[model samples]
Structure formats: structure tokens, C-alpha cells
Target chain A: MSLNATLIAQLIVFLILVWFTMKFIWPPIMRAMDERAKRIADGLEAADRARKELADADTHAAEEIKKARAEAAVIIERANQQAGQIVDKARADAMLEAAKQKAQAQADIDNMAHRARAELRGQVATLAVQGAGKILGREVDAATHKALLDQLVEGI
Target chain B: MTTEAPSSSSYILHHLTYLQLDLRTWKIVENSQNFWVVNIDSIFFSVLLGLVFIGLFWPMARRATHGVPARWQNFVEVCTEFVDGQVKDAFHQKSKFVAPMALLVFFWVLFMNIMDLLPVDSLPTAAEAMGIGHLRVLPSSDPNITLSMSLTVFFLCFWYSFHCKGLKLVAREAFFHPFGKWLLPVNFVLKVVEELSKPLSLGLRLFGNMYAGEVIFILLAAMTLHYSAPAHLAPLTGTAFFIFSALALVTVGLVAYGKGPWMRAWLPLLILPAVIAAGSIFGFLPAIGGGAYFQILFATGWGIFHWLIIGLQAYIFMVLTVAYLSMAAEHH
Candidate 1:
């Protein structure tokens, strides 16, 4: 064959090769590739979903923590208020007890003084009656004894 | 010498030649004078081969499962992905249809290439007995098939360019950018050459590689036949010679074994001896370098070892196609 003929033949063959392959082989290949890309996109979507769930859980946990802290603060404040009331009540009761003890002591002193005074008066009367009876020197009647005692008492 | 013994080289060359067909037309359209036609044996077998490929793959497509694919289904998916990945990497533009087109090119071309791996004498000898001639089964080896397939791809590329960019944009790319408005004539010429070269290079590359490999295998078989040992010597001294050779080989093996531990300490020392031994035993290793055996080796290696390439190529192609379509849709 001439060089030109050979080149033309080569050209024709080349054209045919390209034609057949493009028609038959390419479609299936592209379909498979599309399937693969879709699979990857799906995997990414799953990951995103998991991330969202995780973030929600974290937010929930933080909310729970804040609620618990608020509850603890209220309980602590209540306990402090109750403790202050108890201290104030104890002080008031102690002051009342001290005042009652002072009053009782004062009343006992007054009663002791009155009883001593009465005893002293009785002793003095007895001594005076004995001395008068000795001076009169007789087992006199009630009217004579009385008249002597009266004269002695008037002179002292 | 009563009959000259046929030399091994001549034997090999004879087997490799194609049976020719005459399809030339001389007077108007009645009788063809000297134009070639399809070899009867080749046509029958090539069709049969095409059917076999379709049969193998079509069923996988038909019974494609939706969820948690079976082994066969997975295999198909992997193969598809591999082709797509390659296409995506090579061509950046997304074609609504071009990526799939590239995929078809890869697989069909691959199937055609694999036909060369069949035994050299099997198909042709069978055809001869059946009174048929000019059998050429491997389509990749045929320039006609390869070039035709490549040109189709080239045209598809042009179609995609035209469809995606529009006629005006394609024209601008062809005649405008590289050269200024002043050099539109020169730019047009260069563009034409560039466009023409695509299919020519692509088709020729695949065809030449496959055909050369087929020629080499035929040559190797001829060598084995020519180097056949004597007939009478097989019975008489064959057993004694075998025993002697076996003993020598055993001794050599023992020496090599003893040297292995020492050799392990120094890799450089062992490399030469290993190469020599391997070369002598395998007879220079078939197909030298990058021949048919090499091509098969490379293809098989790619299939087995660099499997990632196949899948990646498929993926890239698919994504690019999608991206292109999305862009084109926006324009519309």
C-alpha cells in the first residue's frame, strides 16, 4: 500500500475505535461513578446528623446543670434563714430566764427580813415581863402586877 | 537432506500472518476486484466473544440489588467505580453523558485487549479445520476496531464541548484565545490539527501495543517446538541423564540454601546470583520488557495491586459530570 493509503487506513481505524468505545463503555462507567459519589454524600449527611445530636445532648446537659445550681442556691438560702431564726429565739429565751431569777432572789430577801424583825420583838417582850415580876416581889394578883409594870415602863 | 527441516523463526512468522480477503470492485458495482473483506472465522469468533462479555456482565446489571450488595454485585460496582474515577481525573468537565461514555470506552477496550491473552494456535487452527480463513479475534489488536472506538470518543468530546459551551464558545476557544484576533487564521489551523490528533493517538496507542504482544507469543511457542529434545534419546539415556541432572541440581540447591543466611547479611551480593539463576531457568523471561506478557502482567497488576486507581477514576468522572451538568443547567 502507498504511504497515503496506509495513513488513511490508520485514520479510519482510529476513528472506529474511538466511536465504539464512546458508545458502549462510557455509559456504564459514568453510572457507577454517580453511584459512588452519592454514597459519599450520604456518609457526610450521616455525620452531620450525628453532630447535631451530640450538640443537642450537650445543650441539654448544660441546662440540667444550671437548673440544679439554681435549686441548690434556693435550698442554701432557706437553710441560712432558718438558722438565723433559731439563734434569735435562743437569745430571747435566755434573757427571759435571767429576769425571772432576779425577781425571785429579791422576794426571798424581803421575806427573811420580815421574819427576823418579828422574832426580835417577841424576845424583848419576854425579858421585860420577867424583870417586872422580880421587882414587885410578890405572887400578886393580876391588877397589882399590872400597876407595877406600868410605873417601871413609864420611868424608862 | 530429503526434506529441509523448517526453522523455528519461519514457523512463527507463518502462524502470525492474517488470512486476507479480497473485496475490490472493478466494474461499477457488480464484481469486486480487489477490496478486502472481513475474515469469516474472525467475524464469527469476535461476535461470539462480544456475546460472552455481554452475557457475563448483563446479568449482574439485571439482578442489581439495592441494599448490602452481594459479592457479584459488589464486583460490578467496584469495576464501575474504577472506570469512573479515571474519567473524572482526565477530563475536568462534567458531561451530562460524556462520563458514562468514557466508562464504556475503558471497559470495552479492556475486554478487547484481553482476547490477545488466549492461546495463539487455538482459534486460528480451529478456523482452518472448519474451512474458514483470515481469523483475527482480538479487536484491540485490530487498528480498525481501536481507531473506530477512539474517534467516537473524540466526536463525543466535541459534542459535549459544543453542547456545554455552545457553538460560539467552542469557536472562540478554537480560534481566539492562544492567538490574538490578528492571528485567527493560524489559530484555526492549529486547532484543527489538535482536534484531529486526539483519536489518532488514542486509537493507535492501544492497537499497536496489543498487536505486538500477540506476535511475541506466537514466536515463543515456535521456540519451544524448535528446541525439542531427540526422540530415541528420551528412552535410553533419558532416565540416567535425568538422575544425574537431578543430583547436580540438588547439590546446587543445598549450596544455595547454605549460602542464604550469609547472603541475607548482604543483599547486594545475592542480587546478581538470584538474577542469573532466574534468567537461566525462565529463558530470559517471556516478552522481554513491556511485551504482551508484560502488558498482561501490567494489566493484572493494575487490576490486583492499584485497585484504588480504578475506583478513584470512576468517582472523579461521575462527580465531574455532575458538576458540569449543574453548571450547564444554570446557564439554560
Candidate 2:
């Protein structure tokens, strides 16, 4: 192959191509690739953060549920204690009222017995006085009869 | 096959000749001894291929996105990334110029080499129809074109060496480091040869490979002329039938050897040409006729093999350029 001016022409062309590529072709493509790499990195980091936050939320929800369950148990235990105290007080009040009524009934029975006894004794004295008068077969002295009636009454 | 066919030697010469323009005479010439002559065909094809490269890449470069890319954009991005990776591997220092230059060298050379795969006569024959006397479609096959590219890369190396190492160190290292200043003249000569050989090897290696490949294709084409004569038909037909039968045996052997997918896929590529050549020889396919089938068979085979050379040469050229530049830029 002969060396000719064609070599120079081709050299010029090659240089032009190199310049064109450097000026127009290389930078934008490199920038895009770099930007894409950054975007992917950011996306992965965001996904990692969201996963961590989700784990945190899961633990917090578990704790809240645990606390709510404990509070519910305490309220139930207090209600049961209050219910027992109310039932015991009601039973004690009913027993005290029953004992007081029984006592009053006993008092009323004793007082009524005393009044009936007094009336019966007076009737017996009158009957004895009448029988003595019949035995005497005449009118006896009143003052002497009064003292004897009293003694008869006291004996009845 | 034409009514009056050219002799095989003349056909081969005609294919190899360039459509050169003589600057001294200011006219297209058959052949020129003038130093000012330019091979118009090589220049035209090389420049067109370069334009095609830039045109295809320019749009993608303009619209490149950080988001998901379109299919064509993806292809361009892959090529860019591949070239960038090669440059990054070889040239550790950051330089805006090297990667793009590598990209241009690779794709441009690749495009030029691919022209060889076009049926050797297709473009030249069409070019002939347009009153062009001679045309060689492959630019890399031309010494001027390959040397021009390699020389440009060599210039970049010189620029980087001087810029990075500075004048004193470069001269001192050139004259001293490889051997020593005690043998100054010897070191100088050795350095000169070593420095010159980088571009020489880069340019000539590509030219030799592509030139040899083109010559083989021309020879395969010339075979059609050789065998198209009635006197040669019997031998041609006999050879075709032999090759067909041999290929059949190979196919059978491959099938018996556990029929790998690669064997299945490639066997057809090897067999199809033989089938056509044989069929044409036997008058089973009279349309192609005669020894034209031989051209088809060998050309197809060579063209397939040349595909590897085309891609490989381009890659080698790019990688070597990057390596040379990296070496030039490296600090002692």
C-alpha cells in the first residue's frame, strides 16, 4: 500500500470524530448513569428505613396491647372486690334489722302478759269477797273486810 | 456469472484496487505514484461510517435518562458502558478525552470491518454501475486508513506523556530509565524503536488482518470464474458432491455424540452452504447454476469467521490505544 495524502485526510477525520464524541457524546451519558446509581442507592436506603420503622411500630403496638390487657385485668379485679363488699354489707344490715325486730316483739309479749295478770288477780279478789259474805249469812263490817281483801289479793 | 467473464487474477486485482483521486492531475486515476493521491473510496466509506456512528449515538446521548431506558437507548448505553469500563480498567486517571476516543475508535473500526462481510462485489458492482472504476468498501483494509487512526492515537499518547511527565522527566526517562544514561545512544535508539512500534503494530496489525481477510474473500469470489467453464464443471460438481457427503457424515457423528445445542445450531450453518452448492452442482437448483455455488459455500464460511476478526480487531485496537495512553500517563 502506498503512503499518500489520504493518511492525512483520515487523520483529520479521526481527530474530528474524537472531538465530536468528547464534546457531544460522553458527558450526558455518564451523568445519567451516575444519577441512576444515586437514585437506586436512595431507593434502597428509603426501603431500609421503612422496614425499620415498620418493625418499631410492630413492637409499640404489642406494648400497647400488653398495657391495655393489664389495665382491663386490674379493673375487673377492683369490680369483683367492690361487688363482694356491697354483698357483705347488705347481709349484715338485714341480720341487724331482724334481731332488733325480734327483741321488740319479745318486749311487747312481756308487757301484754303483765297487764292480763293484773286483771285476773282483781277478778279473783271480788269472787272471794262475795263467797265470805255468803258464809257469814249477814252484812259484815266494811273496814275489816277491806284489810282481808287486800291479803287475799296478795296471796292470789 | 457474466457472458464474458474476467480472468481470476484480473478480477482479484480489480477488487483490491482503490478508487483513488490524483491530487496532482486533479482527476480520478487508475493507479498513481503521486504522493498527493487520495483513496477516495476508503475515505468516503470511513467518513460515512464515522457519521453513522455519531448519528446513531448522538440522539441517545442527547436524551439519556437516569430512569429506565428505551431499547435502542439501552443498546447505546451498553456500548458506552462497555467502552467506559475498558478505559477505566486501563487508564486509572480520569480523562475526558480517552474514553470517547476509545468509543470512536472501536465503533468506527467495527463499522469499517463489517463492510467486508457485504458480498464482496455487491457495493463495488453497484459503484461500478455509477461510473466508478474501482471501489474497496472496507476502510480498515487500507493501510492509509488504519495508519491514520493509529497515528492519531499515538499523538494522544505523546500529548499525555509530555503533559503528565513534563519535558525534563520524559526526556530523561526516555534516554535513561529503560537502560541508563551510560549507554545514552543505545537507550535513545531503543526508546525510539519502542515508542514507534506502538503505533506501527497497532496500525499494521489491523491492516494485515483485514487485508488478508479481504484477499481471501476475493479469492473465493474468483473461484466462481475459475469453475464456471464447462471444461471445469465435472471436477466442480464432483468436489461439491464429495463435500456434501463428508458434511453429512460429520452431522451424523455430531448427532451420535449427544447432540449438543451448539452442535445443533452451528451444524446447519455449516451444512446449508454445502447443500446449496451440491444442489446447484447437480442441477437440482438450476437458478444459481454452475460453480457460483462454490463461491457461496466458501464465502459464507469465511464471512462467518471474518465476523470474529472484525469485532476482535476493533476491540484490540481500542484496548491497545487505551493501554498505551495509560502507560504514557502513569507516573514513574
Against the true structure, what is each candidate's TM-score?
0.54, 0.81
Backbone clashes counted, model 2: 0
- lDDT value for model 1: 0.52
The top-ranked prediction according to DockQ is 2
Worst 10 residues of 2 chain A by lDDT: A138-147
The 10 consecutive residues of candidate 1 chain A with the worst lDDT sum are: A1-10
Model 1: residue A70 alpha-carbon error in angstroms = 7.2
Structural similarity of chain A in candidate 1, as TM-score: 0.51
lDDT of 2 at B259: 46
C-alpha DockQ of every model:
0.10, 0.59
Q: Write the per-residue lDDT of candidate 1 for residues A1-156, one digit (tens) a residue.
A: 101122234344434433544455444434554665688789899999999999999999999999999999999999999999899888988888888887888778878876776565545445566655578774445454556555554544
Q: Give the per-residue lDDT digits (tens) of candidate 2, residues B273-303.
A: 6764554344311125466677778988998
